[model samples]
Target: MNDRPYHHGDLRRAVLTAALDVIAADGPSGLSLRDLARRAGVSHAAPAHHFKDRTGLLTAIAAEGFGLLAATVNEATDLKDAGVRYVRFAREHPAHFQVMFAPGLLRTDDLELTTARALATDALRTAVAEVRPAEQGDDARLAGVAAWSLAHGFATLLQSHNLDGAVGGRDPEEVFRTLSGLLFRQG
Candidate 1:
């Protein structure tokens, strides 16, 4: 007999939000469906109904992360803006960052994940092109790689606390702007 309160008005969303909170504090490894249920005040089996398994829950999280990234980048004013926003997103959603990029943590082949990732990729590539405008595919592709690597690396380092002193206490966005400008040799 499932004796939990099961008071969630929208169990799926409540569970997902609770999962994000859990992930933020404990990382993905610390998450459990039962714990999520408890946090959501739902029956333990309620989460299972929404997510067949842990992988299913993680897959949904990853998909949402990519969509969030896409929206964040697409709203930026320029390549530098996009880079700054990427870092900001990472900082704001550390749990999503942790689960989204870690391939082994989620079902990468899930259709929802693939579609969301494609959208994020397209948005990122467009921003990268703005970094170094070019007509040739190779140049643009390489520039995109460079831009993505810069932002991803910066964000990853910051998220992991490896860059506490790398930027000398300046805001992360400023540090990224400076590094990106120097790397791309842009004004």
Candidate 2:
């Protein structure tokens, strides 16, 4: 429908959904405000109003990603479950996963993004606490870092399809569970 009639109804959501579709199809580098507007059936300036610039849009996606991640991580029964969920989240939301890690593309100072990131971090740290005994200072921080690094690295590789054939036809989370077991299980 060329010359589409537009209304302000859910325009912001439409733009964000269009942005996700664009990111899913063409990667973040290919994202354009004009294209988002076209996809959302809004004026070019509409997207700009919602997200001041490209970085703002990316920041929105990153913030959304972290919020989703925090919710997923919180669903875990333990650290191993959290790791598995993390990988699954990456697999399911590839676009979000990609944008969430690329700091250079997003507005790092965005309050929503920072807050959502903190939520995700808190979720991860909660899982880490289950993985390691109660400890003070850097010890707990170190454990959380190590746990996050391992799970994140695995999720990244899984998202890139680096572990495609390794797991055969089995569920990816199952493999993640097995891998997580290696670290979660202590001697």
Best by lDDT: 1
- How displaced is residue 158 in candidate 2, in Å? 1.2
lDDT of each: 0.88, 0.86
Model 1 pairs in collision? none
Per-residue lDDT over 58-149 for candidate 1, one digit per residue giving the tens place of the 0 to 100 score: 89999999999999999998888899999999999999999999899888999999999999999998887666666867988898888889
Candidate 2 lDDT for residue 92: 87
lDDT of 2 at 180: 78
Cα error of candidate 1 at position 68, Å: 0.6
Q: Report the poorest 10 consecutive residues by lDDT, candidate 1.
A: 1-10
Q: What's the lDDT of the predicted structure labeled candidate 1? A: 0.88
Model 2, range 90-168, lDDT digits (tens) per residue? 8889899999999999889999999999999999988888757557668878988888898889888877778788977
For candidate 2, list the clashing residue pairs, or say none: none
